[model samples]
Target: MKLTLTPSTIHPPFGRYAHGVKATGSGILVASGQLGIGPDGTVPADAEAQARICMDSIVAILREGGLTLGDVVRLNAFVTHHDYFAPYMAVRDEYLADLRQKPASTLVVAAGLSRPEFLVEIEATAVF
Candidate 1:
């Protein structure tokens, strides 16, 4: 089972995410951070497109483990610049919209990623 936590004592999350998530299940799966590169080895120039690719990779990883987005308990995302924040969040929110209990999430603006062309990276932790 999973429980979303947003206690009245603290401010609500600014986005589509819970302040924390309490999960109890058989095991936890932590996916590595995924870059914006696609299977064709192409990286989109647009931040929103890159963000979508990152989220898609995360979804594929979760599905491989027999889990869905709803099973996700946490998310950590990194963007190359402050300008990319909104675009990244927009893509992320679209992916997580249907979940009953949103996962705890964090978004960071980094100086750069492994590759200069890469604009975003996303990782997830899921319980199953």
Candidate 2:
């Protein structure tokens, strides 16, 4: 697995994830849906905030599986707010901006996430 730092016009690196990442292997990690729970098990109150936390959780899961965002070949985003497009893109670009190759992704809107506070959840599939 390889990790890389990317540049972006989006948000700053939150220190929770690499700007971009890459992985190579016979197989890659398939991340389960991540939640908004914080490292200390705290859940943020707002939808957008929780979405960021979910992204943070996915980052940790990818690292454990020996991969990074660049290794992600696909992404599925489940969001609660239709108006969150820009916020989501800002955060998304922050992680993907410098990737040499970009993953295919789709966004979906749901009535809600696992928790009422979970604004969004991103599940990923990686190919190495």
Q: Write the per-residue lDDT of candidate 2 for residues 27-123, one digit (tens) a residue.
A: 6566666666665657766656766765776666676656678888888888788887667667777778889998998988899875676677777
- TM-score for every candidate vs. truth? 0.79, 0.73
lDDT of each: 0.77, 0.68
Query: Tens digit of lDDT per residue, candidate 1, span 1-128?
Result: 65554444322334576534445464776666777877767788999999887787667666655678998899999998999999999999999998889999999999998789989988888887
Clashes of 2: 1
User: Clashing residue pairs, candidate 1?
Assistant: none
Q: Residue 60 of candidate 1: its Cα lDDT?
A: 67
Every candidate's CA RMSD: 11.5, 8.1
